[model samples]
Target chain A: MPDLLSPALIMIVAAMAIGPAKGHLRTAVLLLAPLITLWAIWQVPDGVQGTVKFLSYNVEPVEGSALRRLFATVFALMVFVGGLYAFRLARWYELAAAYAYAAGAIGVCFAGDLIVLFLYWELMALFSTVVVWCGGTPAARAAGIRYAIMHLLGGVVLKVGIEGVLISTGSIEIRPLLATDFSTWMILCGILINAAAPPVSAWLADAYPEASPTGSVFLSAFTTKTAVLVLILLFPGEPVLIGVGLFMVVYGIVYALLENDIRRILAYSIVNQVGFMVCAVGIGTELALNGAAAHAFAHIIYKALLFMSAGVVIYRTGKTRCTELGGLYRTMPVTTICCIIGALAISSFPLTSGFTTKSLISLAAANEQMVWVYMTLTAASAGVFLHAGIKFPWFVFFQRDSGMRPKDAPWNMAAAMIIFAALCILLGVAPQWLYPFLPYPIEYEAYTAGKVVFYLQLLLFSGLAFFILLPLMKRTETISLDVDWLWRRAAPWLLQQGSRGLQPLLVFSASTWQSLEALSKRMAVNYLGQPETADSEERGLFARSWPIGATALWIAILLSAYVFIYYTD
Target chain B: MSDSDSQDFLSRPQTIRRLWWGFSIVLALTVAAQLVIYVKGYFVVDGWFGFGAVYGFLSCLLMVLAAKALGYFLKKPADFYQQDEDDA
Candidate 1:
């Protein structure tokens, strides 16, 4: 064993302790585990720290780099904050599952080989399903099953690719590879599925909102962001990601615009935000990679803050629809303010974390002179402000009053939101703190005069458009269908239709067989002997009785004829 | 929690009107700031005066309308999936 313990182990062990421990002891484990993990994360020096023999291969379970540390830092931070939010209210099992899920994500951050990465990846899939199921509703159970299926499918595809890579390249070390071969392409597809890329992206919007309020907050932080991290590590510069990323950006905006559920809106926006990172990774320059890494970091905080606020609403009012929520700003001031800050940060407004990190991606695109991608991404930026930045706060907090006044979040939840909300602004204002931790050296400024002015014009006008078209964007108690409809609705309907279509053929075949049997029986009755009685009329040839002496005489005559013919031949 | 007493100031009609006017002015100033400050842009067209405002507004308009149009096909009742679960 290496001198430095794996940070993932600490969280997993804490997760184990959480279920049986009670009161302050459980709380102590919940709060201290992540802090201890954070300390352990920093303790590991750069490069591969240790290896263990597994089967025939020496697997690297711990690697240290700026990128790895950055991701692990956020994962640990998320666990700590998420624990603080949930410890008081969340069920013991939910808290346990959430910690385990966080441990899986942290494990992936330090994984030094494909095999190690895969084990952690699956650990995440298994436990996140448990988190989703913690919602404890039939809906949650069903959604958890669907969520499990999609991620497990992704894991299988990833395993197949890793196995193929190991066979062809004779190595399992996690390194950059292009989608130029079957194995690499499979790897890219697998990662994209986890990233919630299109056609298969609906599982995220379907599942996250259905989890328990606090569970959703934990659910929101880990899975897709881990997918983004691995993409940064394994498949940077894969050109297909640009198109996939752009689609996600636009898809999120459109669907979120049409959605009525508050958390579902945020869930779609997760896809949209990850789209930015995925696109940045595709750009593949040092600046682009930094943008992707920094954006992931900033995104996790603000997105979690947003979820935390929404979770508070769901926790207080048991209502998830936009139509059922309004005028909350008066009563739940802290949550409203924190949510707005998160919204602004997501919109990449002038002095928020989103602005600082997301602009780096657009800057990367511009540096490459990819005019179309730059333009489209610039437009998508405005779209984000419309769907998430204004729409979320407006519908839930500021629109026509629902005449219900729920109290503010409980102290711990409020503290969690305030902490992340503060981080959103802090990182935005002082990106120098974040930039140094990026994988590459920094050579960019986030708040140049031109950039700030340009972004302000873009976002503010989009805000204008939002209010101007408020009627069109009204909540309608509806959900927009996505590709998951294939399994959720279309595939099942197809099976039903198929069975309906096959019914007549099956009947026809059965009738035909019955008639053939009758015909054969009639032929036997006519050609061969049968009992000539009314009771035996329906009997088939094999069922009929014949006179024994006549039958023996006929057999003997036939045998003699056969013997004569054989002798003549 | 009283409906009349707890009505938020921002929701009052007068405050709303004032907010609308204030917001409009800020929007105008962002575009007008281009006169004094030369806002460098990577793309040629993006550099044009009020381009960000115009493009941003237009893109949002297009997206909202596009979503509304898509809603006709894609939008289903809140229990869309739940209905299937019930059948099963």
Candidate 2:
């Protein structure tokens, strides 16, 4: 019990202590503390390690189970990678808040009961908003406020759902709750919103890109992936997620196909990848679950690598759009190479990390005999190559020569990319290492020859399509609209329209009140005269003379009237 | 790495040749690695099914070409959207 409490407290304190430092010291502390917390997390052997009871309600801070450990492991790794990208350039305050956010994520993953999960979940919401605000721009500040509001609303829904579930079910263990109750569905929706699932996914592309470059790198790792983890645990085999996941996948590709901004393209694709995970959770097979976990790990490294490369470009040239930048490969070869490696990995080119992991989820779909969904996933895979895989590097590095020749990324940045790229290839070649740690046992082979050949042909054909269709894929002045535009643009326009109509009614009411006051004042002054003031020296006639005489006369009259009435009756 | 020398590689294409050679070598090496895996399949009497090696190499080649082709469109003039003074 003390052991679990100790690590959470330790990580929280480490985060709080980060505010006082500056320069390299700040970076070191932020990066190092998570490593220690990670080690502490795995120190206990697996299965129910800590508990406390408050008579009716019992709580466990640490549930040393395989599922919990798997999530905690990834959360810890994210901390390190997030630190690597962020600490080098982020303000100490930002780094501090980021570490605190990470600690909260780890806390949630390790939590055994609903109450603890809710607490850590809200903490994650709180601290991540602080990190977003650290972008220190008007756009970031506004986006952060919106981001915070959305998360707080989600948190409230989740808390109410948790209470309801606890009351009805009489158990708070964080395991498969099924899709039976409104409370469970509400919880699922709340979590899905963080996962960047439909309708509200605009929050991610809108809010994330506005953050500081380092902040984006950190922001990319945690929120959606953690939701994937929760879904895997709680909603496995729920068939509805299959359709919902499919929607997210197609929506992501179509939106990204039309997007102009580079990071937002990546952001939408994050939804697409999590959609794959969500589908895997829905499939609920052994291979599907394993694939979801493996894909998540690979996605983290490659996505972070992608964001870091983008950050390096933005840091040097202060540009982010494909339209604004090009020909950088002339000087920044390392970054170009790094970005390409990340792209290939994302495209699931056969020998990269993505193929090794992502194939399992697709294979799981095939095994389930879901042909249409399977076909859509295959098409989405091709579209991934089209937008993110091809478009990102092509536009960023090698196009008709932007003639801006920034030097290669700073050494630390290059080191981070190289490490991730190596891991991408390593994992692809020797997937056995990743295979063991997945949430479920994986009986499927990722590198079957027939399957590999088919995938290559299909994806290569898609590459051909990308080049053939390049004319339609040009950068333009106008922003490509999405469901988010409905909120960020149309909703705001509607709100302004509403307020405009409201303005006249409010003004008319105020004017009417003023006119009524004027009429009353005019009537009093001209005809009735004002009442005596409160501080006048003499009493009024009504107050002083009437009460005693009136009381005696009224009493005698009432008695005579009563006697006459009684005789008449 | 100091900001003083950050502009050292700002105008050169020396890495361009290196990138070309390096990418070719990578293409070759990746294909060779997969070819070894493919050769073991030759003994199993499924010659028609033994296109994994070719498919693998072809995928790498396709990837690099896609790299070149995409390089055609989205890559723009570095100062394409910047203010005029920043361009100078």
Candidate 3:
């Protein structure tokens, strides 16, 4: 019988085991834990399976639904494959933190209440910062601090919303919430922060590239995608998300077009890809929701594949900027071919997973008669092909030879890439294999002759445009300023100036207090013969020695006035 | 998969000429495909002949130009953020 255990808990336990289990034993646990969790996920049936009471509220730790299963299944698979890619290359603690991070993602997947989900949300934030710090460079350490602060602030915002909801509604059930009230809007804000929605979107690009190569591959799989999942659950059909998602799509492309680092380009594209899922959630039809879910699944596969390929390049050559690397294809053909496949998949080229899945989103826009939206989405599709699909491979693999002939990917890394590459094509050819795993039943057809032709023309012509505009798209060693600059530079600068400006006021106040005490003491010594007052300052009019006759007359006048007024009232 | 053939194919001027011709032919085939496959146009302008090709090409040009314009304002020295950290 399948034990009723939270799969996330199993992975968390595996993380604990890794700290002391040395050498091969540690590898076995790292590899087996995710495999075991995969089995546990499959064994879960569609309903609430495990519940516990905490603080007079029932918290369901295992809620079996199609959406939860799909997300958990992919997350589990990512941990296993990401581990395979990392085991030979990464430090043991990095693997441990990564597994714990994956566990937190899985925990959120099965969480049936807002409180439980928030806990898992925090778990991910804590451990992912460690993964970023594992990069061990000064840059990584700084980036990780920024990353943690952003997520923690997001966590606090989410907690406040949860508290408000609990007080008002007297329930913690995770259910659909429209942004009709302050609490719901707060919840939406909190979730969008994690989704890398605008204003805060820079965190994704800012920190992700600073992580170790294996750390980045794992980072690519979770966080924003999980936010996409939660959005699908909580705020489907919220019309405002349509605008937000579109902004992200265009922003990602424009920034990616400007990016120089290989991984940072991939990072910007993550926001772009997640933008499609977010837009679909706003469409909120069964077809659109399925499109969102399926696209998330397909994206995790191909994006990780792309990042894995990039990781190998970084591992062997110790370089990441596009201006410094190229012509590696001659020696690293396997890595190059795998990268092209990943590129094609991300661009939704014909007979790849992206084509099979991303079309459903465009089709959803068309079905809704959103003419402007449909046009922009179609245009962005071509832009994706330009910035990520072509730019990544062309600049990193096929551009002007930097004369660096690094070795091909090691066995483990190559194995991981090959598996994902195969899945990209396999799912494209037979999408039915993935469709059944979606949150809704699949009724839409993906492949029509017209769509195939339309996409081919769009993506191919974009490629042609890329070659034509080759001179304009020159690589430069530069970084684009993002919203994080306000906090990173402007906020710090303002704080420093404020402190420096306040210093004189503080010193003046302290000296004035000392002088007052000295005068008061002198007055006390002279008049009252108290030693404690020997340094006291002279008092004002109220503290002067007054004649008894005058004081009594004044008190009598004030008392008479009060008594007269009181009697009249 | 010999080194000479691979090198000559990518490096030679003749190969470049052939590639351009091949690319033009493929573009022509896609334009021709519009005549045979009836696209269910989602909007009024979408039904125009070779509309997808024109729109795709023009949109790409616009995106690249827009991106380049934005890059002028947004791009900074790669060490812009790092300078403060090193100072600290």
Best DockQ among the predictions, by candidate number = 1
Question: Taking the tens digit of each residue's C-alpha lDDT, what string does model 1 give over A1-569?
Answer: 66435789999999999989999999999999999999999987899877889998999999999999999999999999999999999999999999999999999999999998999999999999999999999899999999999999999999999999999999999999999999998899899999999889999999999999999999999999999999999988989889999989999999999999999999999999999999998889999999999999999999999999999999999999999999888899999999999999999998899999999999999999999999999999999999999999999998888888999999999999999999999999999999999999997878878777888999999999999999888789788888988998889989999989999998999999999999987788765546466575556656667799989999999999999999999
Residue B71 lDDT (model 1):
94
Rate residue A257 of model 1 by lDDT.
93
Ranking by lDDT: 1, 3, 2
Residues B39-61, candidate 2: write the lDDT tens digits. Answer: 22222332233243343334434
Q: What's the lDDT for residue A210 in model 2? A: 80
The worst-scoring run of ten residues by lDDT in candidate 3 chain A lies at: A532-541
Lowest summed lDDT window (length 10), candidate 2 chain A: A536-545
TM-score of 1: 0.90
How should the candidates be ordered by TM-score, best one leading? 3, 1, 2
- Writing each residue's lDDT as its tens digit, candidate 2 over A310-356 gives 88999989987878887788789899998998998888888899999
Docking level for model 1: medium
In candidate 2, how many Å is residue A512 off? 6.7
Where model 2 places Cα greater than 4 Å from the true spot, the runs are A6-8, A53-56, A499-569, B1-88
TM-score of every candidate: 0.90, 0.80, 0.90
lDDT for position A387 in model 2: 71
Residue-wise lDDT of candidate 3 within A49-164, one digit each (tens)?
76788788887777779999899999999998998899998998999999999999998998888988999999999999999999899889989999999999999989998888
Structural similarity of chain A in candidate 2, as TM-score? 0.88
